[model samples]
Target: MIHQIRIDNFKSLVDFEIGLSRFSCLVGLNGAGKSTVLQALDFISQQMRGDIDSWLEQRQWEPRDLGSKLTAKQNVDISVQVETEKHGLIEWSASFNRQSLRCTTEEAFCDGVRLLKVEDAEFWIDRSVKQGSLRDVRSEIMFEYQGSILSQLKRKQIGEPLQALKEVLANIRSLDLLSPEHLRQRTRDSAGHLGLGGQKLSAYLHEQGSEVRQRLLEKLQHAYPQLASIDTRSLRSGWKHLDIAEQFSGKVLSTPARHVNDGLLRLLAVLSQLASDEHFLLFDEIENGINPELVEFLVDALVESEHQVMVTTHSPVILNYLEDEVAKQGVIYLYKNAKGATQSIRLFEIPSLAEKLQFMGPGEAFIDTQLTELATEIQSLSAKGGKDVSAAKR
Candidate 1:
């Protein structure tokens, strides 16, 4: 599991560190750096997958090089610390240059000593010219040219370490970015190992036999009593479909996996991922497209799983479902500071209120209490001549 992440000069993150828990929720308004955190994790995992170049390309690095452009002074420096049950401690750092539009230096450390550094020309050094200039210097450097530590360990026949890393990566899956169209295609294909968008749900289900399928059905039924049975079938045209029978009605209803509601599909995706042997899971916007009534069930299911789950949500409904113990375990609140930089504070760090009032519901209480407090602070500052004047006078 990732114990902490420290980001410097990465997009909006100038310098920030966040500690994690087994089941964590990151809540804040939009554009508050929530998605950036998920993307940062994705970048780390992609680097381990030997796809750092491709990942950098997605960020629009012109020269398509990482080692040549990423530097501590020129670009952003990112340091991540992950704690594992088997391997102990692993740390990774990379420098990204916004001006040069590339990553120049990349390094990985195990238990604090440098294990890998890929800035040499042999790993990556390409020639490229400016728009009208004829000169060319080392344009890009491939950080994972020798493959990731995880991949190298696997190739070396280190089964335990590879398994441990794989479990950690699997748990970092980000499903919220999945698109409806992508989900439809996956349902149509019935592929296994459902990707972020659940495009592989059908395939995964199709690969399973009656026993495993029945087990999944049972698990789903246990979480959702309304679901009588869940089954998968392949058509002659090579399309796969999921059949969901409602408990109240005996009639069996079928929907092309694509036709399923977003909420239902999202819930299934979460459950399927949690059911895997992964040790940690991080979810952004956990409440997106999910029903309020099912939030509690979803939380319960997550709690039952052996893997640690971290979810980011703005919904009090979802927060309410979390047990007090779990809530106190690792809850983080993301807020923008006076300088417009994003920072995180532990939810428990906030003082309990006096004259507590009974809330109609968790959602209501969250808005009336937590959110209201922040809003009131903002209002008070605005009334006192806003941020600019206040700062100038001080």
Candidate 2:
């Protein structure tokens, strides 16, 4: 699991680092850079899977503004430190110049010690040994950077440590709130792991066994009481159509999946993700189109999956449900500093959190912290003018 993450000179996340829990939530007002963090993580993962250029094109990010516009920095840095019960601790990081996104420096470490460092075109791998130790790996390998060294090593099985880091980085999955219409379509691509936008849900559902399918249907029923049944029909055209029944209809009437409520459709997409085998999950704008009443069920869905999950939300109802599942430390509050940089504070890390939680629910506590005064607006530095800006009263 990823124990922590550090992102520098990437969009709004300039020199940002945060500790992670098995389950965590990013709480912030609009434009607080929560999505920026998720994007940075996604960018790095995509770089490992493919290359920087392809990832940028896939995301449709304007290359001119991909790097931190807040500074003249020529490169961006993204890193994650992960620890497993068996493999211990490892850190993987990459630095690529913004202009060409060509690799500048890429490095990995084991237990806080550097294991490999890659510069412009040169690669270095350390195989250090303790004197007279039978487990000596003092030999090292050096290669010119054609692409990511970690990716190269994994493809070649050159080193166990590099392979571990490559595997972890390649496994990162970030699921943004899915598009309803996109979810309704017959998926053109069938991915074992769900895509960043939660497409191919139809294919995913059709591929699951009876037990998992029943569980997914039950989750849908919990969110949409009227949802009686869901099944996929393979047409003569060899395409799949997701069909559903209403609770009152008792399987007599079936509704095409496209007709499902927007909120219900999003919930279905989320449930599909929860049912997956991925070890780590990141979701952006998770509250979009979800029923406020079903917030608790959503919490249960995430918790029951037992994956290392992170989501960003502005919903207090969601927070109230999360309060019971995650400790105070599991909540990270993202706010904008005067410099317009993103800043974070764990709710539990605050000494006075108990006093606030005692008087009100977690949702209310979050609102209380965000308030300057009843009449005054939440403030931030204006990125355009570098002046103080006010947000309307919550």
TM-score top scorer: 2
lDDT for each residue of candidate 1 in 1-394, tens digit (9 for 90 to 100): 7777776655455566777776777776777667666666665555455545454564555422232112244555666666777668766566554544333566555554444444643222111111222122223343334224343334333234334544565356555465556555634453345665566776666666667767766777765677756667777777776655665566655656567778777776677777665566667787777777777878788776777776778787876776655665555666665555556655544443112213233344455665436534543555675442111111
In model 2, the clashing pairs are: 127-137, 127-138
TM-score of each: 0.72, 0.83
Total residue pair clashes for candidate 2: 2
Regions of candidate 2 where Cα sits further than 4 Å from its true position: 126-147, 209-211, 235-238, 247-251, 324-327, 351-354, 372-394
Q: At residue 189, what lDDT does model 2 achieve?
A: 40
> Per-residue error at 382 for model 2, in Å?
21
- lDDT (Cα) of model 1: 0.57
- Give the lowest summed-lDDT range of ten residues in model 2: 372-381
Alpha-carbon runs more than 4 Å astray in model 1: 52-74, 96-114, 117-171, 179-181, 186-192, 234-239, 247-249, 352-365, 370-394
Error of 1 at 215 (Å): 2.4
| Model 2 per-residue lDDT tens digits across residues 42-87 | 7766666656666666577766666776777877777778886655
